[model samples]
Target: MRRLDPRPCVVAVAVLAAIAALTGCAPDAQPGPGPAASETVASPTDAATPSSPTPTPSPTEPALDPDGSAEDNLPLFTEVVEKVWKTDDRVKGRAYIDALVRAGFDKASMEVTKDRSSVGIPADSIQFSVRWTDACLVGQVGPSTKKPAAVVLPHLPTGGCLVGETRPIDW
Candidate 1:
């Protein structure tokens, strides 16, 4: 038989007493019985199973052709550019204009010029000139007199996505 040390026994009892005291002092430490067991109820053997299946919607009718004019689709281009601009300035600006021009606006016939000037002791100014596509309508944005600091001619709105009058402003 091995004999236990008194000091070890004393330490063990002290630690246990401390633990018990702590557990007792805890706010919600009562060791109560858990919730009662759930009651078992009888179920119908031949109950019809519930079903939920969404009906597929009928396909939407296709839009009619607007006389094959690019001008008719101007609103679409404006909406696309607006949405693109919300998240991407670079994409909404020069990149969008380039895409429109490349996609057939290169032959725009109307010539529009924009001139910007900052009035102050030390002056700052710029100018730009652009051409409108014959296939659609006017398409230009920039300085009017000399070369502009930058120019971007994004697609304009016609009468589909949104209705608004767009005008160039000098600032």
Candidate 2:
């Protein structure tokens, strides 16, 4: 495969570790002026209104490395995936795949499961991945998944990351 330019951004090799830290862990730098905190509370007796912390103007995140191994990119990868999980489109595989593309990952290196099963039923969950050299940057999400998950796993013996057949990223 042709090498994509390495961009600084952001993995978990352990599946469980991926979902453990999903919320409010987005890149410290966000576009425009937006609330940095997801929620705020104030003491009823306090005279001052609650204020959210100002987000850093620059990315406090590790840069994503296209030329690096999955482990080297997990931090920014987790952050990007988590950011997508916090959105309304959290359950859609396309959202995560698209977000990764926008974050500088090569779309050609990615794979994702179908949104629905062959029998026309919505899948319990979906898995997506990017083959990064010897490791795979993988992620899962859906109603059944309960939360977005990610990991870096060694390529399967069959030379792919996921075990089952995956959908095409034709779009």
Candidate 3:
């Protein structure tokens, strides 16, 4: 009686199991609701049954725009801009800002400038100035030696902002 080589068989079974898992056909696979099933709702009770409070909107959903005013949107814009300026130097993950600018927020613009006593990544101390307009932005950034560093963001028709003036701008 010859002993069978178990290694190749074991490897083949492992590969098959991995493939099944990746294809989502494992024994543990469970069915999820279809679109029609998801749309189904339970019947509402009469007025005698108190209604449950409405749930808060999810982050993925846009907030209700009361009166649909541009100024109302400004707070959301300012909050995002300030957060990006204070935390990010490279300005990563600012897709929403780009969208806002591209959306022709000619009435929405921002300027940011940084000032520090010493030149370094983590400066000795820093200060920043900002100004925003409907069509343009002016601001400065720096260690404030002879001149402070500045950045200007201009509105774009294609829906994005531009940065300009590495040297301190007149504002």
Candidate 4:
């Protein structure tokens, strides 16, 4: 009778044990959920009851303006401006104005600085604003500016969107 080789058997066992340990299949490891049972499950009587359908607002319904005051809408305006501004570094003046317009700001009441200067040099900063009844919601973004900044300040009694300097939107 040929003698059985125990060396090969020991090496094979060691390899399998190492694989199991590496794969987290140790004997004490907890098992996860298996396939669902073949039996049909039953729900409680209360759970099976049908409830009245809730009415959902239509998509065409206009969204409620944030209190209709620029001060009250400062936070919302800031959030929207930040989201739009971060989308691209090369965003132009019209992009910010358009985004604010889409966010329910009146286009006729909005103003934006040109992306370039009178000499056609790219502006270091750009400003956009919405002229509200008593105040203005202004947002400025650019290399010279910190993160997207927004503010609600009293409208210039002189009749302008912002009090600070802003380039003309010639572009």
Comparing 2 and 3 on lDDT, the stronger one? 2
Could you estimate the TM-score for every candidate? 0.26, 0.63, 0.25, 0.56
In order, the Cα lDDT scores of the candidates are: 0.39, 0.83, 0.41, 0.74
Off by over 4 Å in 3: 1-46, 50-73, 81-109, 115-118, 124-171
Q: Write the per-residue lDDT of candidate 4 for residues 15-94, one digit (tens) a residue.
A: 99999888895454567665479855556965676577668767543342756677777766787788787787434778
Query: Candidate 4's C-alpha lDDT?
Result: 0.74
lDDT (0-100) at residue 125 of candidate 3? 23
Clashes of each: 8, 12, 9, 0
Colliding pairs, model 1: 108-132, 108-133, 114-143, 114-144, 115-144, 127-143, 128-143, 128-144
> Cα RMSDs of all predictions?
19.1, 24.0, 18.5, 13.6
Candidate 4 regions with alpha-carbon error over 4 angstroms: 1-67, 163-171
lDDT of 1: 0.39
Worst 10 residues of 3 by lDDT: 124-133
Q: Indicate the residue-level lDDT of 164 in model 1.
A: 36
Best-to-worst order by lDDT is 2, 4, 3, 1
Expressed as tens digits, the lDDT of each residue in 1-75 for candidate 1 is 998679988999999999999998887567866556785544574344335655889975333233544445455
What is candidate 2's local distance difference test score? 0.83
TM-score of 3: 0.25
